[model samples]
Target: MLSPYKVVTIGDAMITMNPISTGPLRFVTHFERKVGGAELNFAIGCARLGLQSRWISLLGKDEFGRVIYNFTRGEGVDMTHVQFVEGYPTSLNFKEIQEDGSGKTFYYRYQSPISTFTTEMMKDEMLEGVALLHLTGVFLAIDPKNVELVQELIQIAKQKNIPISFDPNIRLKLWSIEEARKVYEMIFPDIDILLTGLDEFRLITGKDSEAELENFAAVYNIRDLVIKDGANGSKLYREGMWTRVSSFKVTPVDTVGAGDGFDAGYVYGWLHSYEPDKLLRFANGVGALVTTVSGDNEGLPYFEEVDAFINNELIIER
Candidate 1:
């Protein structure tokens, strides 16, 4: 059964082709196909945790698009708002992983189908039962018009009194730091929950101190300021109070979608009204679990799995 809480997010999904062997892409002959995207991963993560997750986006009317659509739908994400369009091609990315599980992606999405999605296509009815509206920098970075679309969506979300969560998820490969900073600043004031990395926060605010982060949150009137520090832990600031949680230790197979899982777990805790400490710990656990498996949303755990993992009851088979 689905949880009463619902999460809605808008972004582009892509067909990711990961190299079968470690090292340079040039030397790899075979690849494995997978579906991946920031918002899509978050939606799948939420769905895995039993939330009614709705995704909004456009995909190319092609084989790859069908694969992505089927995979995401099978994960229990609501597909009512997703559409396939002709002419444009679905986006694709090829990943090159090093021996240590770290990797870089090469994108081939110049003619993205999501570029056709406009603000006019967004309807207020789509957000009717949404408990949270999530956004990310990846969508905004895809196209300049997406900035306006997100702004319009934010206005509608605000009108409907839905809380907004945003993850910068900054990708320098998509845009310059200057460009990202400008766009992020424009969206920051409207974000109620800010989920970002410590490095990203420093980069975005150009401030290195916790005091400055507090002042920035105060300036924006952000209710929840969550910082996700991989491996080290995560910290949360709400109502002028701070809650910190240490990360669970895990050997990562791939670190690609860990942050998205963390976002989903955080949202799940938020909807269930978990205390700050428990929320951060749960989120950190989800993130660590994601790194224990490969693929995009493949490692996103159900509520039961997360519970077991957090309690140190989960056993892995080699």
Candidate 2:
């Protein structure tokens, strides 16, 4: 159990099976099992980048839970806050890749142990020394009970002056857009750092232009508003200044955890007091690097790997 972690992330921990063939369940011959949770992915990426990241979640007392526990622990993240409950199973997700390299996922996570989280399971000591509290929209959409837990933690973190890094990884599988927008509006003002997908942000705010987005951030009193433009790049609006950074070039194997990688990289840079350019470049570099592998956080590079990648390394494949 690692102590004095820099960040604390809360969300579901689940397994994903990506089918090799694109067809019905009968025709899809092969499937690969891997961890698939946005907050867990962020925690792993932060750990790889040399941060003592603590991930808090509820997992089932089963083999799937063991896989997540062992894998996350192996990544150097502190899972001491993870609560394992009985009678419920862990969540499972199935991924199907389309012909155009797009992905379609089917989640079988109803009544999962992770979704049964409550404030009692998450003790006060978990937020004692953490500088940042990381959250996502998934937690809000998972279950009604999670609302009390999330809002309580948010209030506690605010009282302790701990900033929150929020990623609205919108998922329609668990909830609808209208529901997401309404909950987000209520949760928006408490968030300090907003790392949002541009499309998702647009969908929620109806702000198509960057200027309009900036205004939206200002209205919410968001300290750091980061707009993720996928391959095009990332834009950061903070301290009354705007900065844009380009993404690194890489042939992607899977695009699952790139955004989480970016969140981790940006957090790492911020913790290390990096300049704006360095922060965005490092973030984009990490985001690009994660796409070279299949699993969510498998390709998340180490400290030296990030340096090498950002500095133009030799001609070789990852």
Query: Which one wins on TM-score?
Result: 1
lDDT of 2 by residue, 1-318 (tens): 232448999989789887868765556889888887999999999988888899988899999999989989988888888978898899999887766767677888888997667676656788888888999998788886776788988988988899998998898878889988988998899998899988888888888687897788889999889988878989889888999998888888878899999999998888777888888999998988888887877888887888888999823285
The ten-residue window of minimal lDDT in model 2 covers 1-10
Model 1 alpha-carbon miss at residue 305, Å: 0.4
- The residue-by-residue lDDT of candidate 1 on 1-318, one tens digit each, is 689999999999999998989998899999999999999999999999999999999999999999999999999999999999999999999999888867788999997999998878989988988999999999999999999999999999999999999999998889988999999999999999999999998887788578988999999999999999999999998999889999998888778899999999999999999999999999999999998888898898899999999999996542
RMSD of each: 1.2, 2.0
lDDT of each: 0.93, 0.85
What lDDT would candidate 1 get against the real structure?
A: 0.93
Q: List the residue pairs that clash in candidate 2.
A: none
Which runs in model 2 stand beyond 4 Å of their true positions?
1-5, 98-100, 314-318
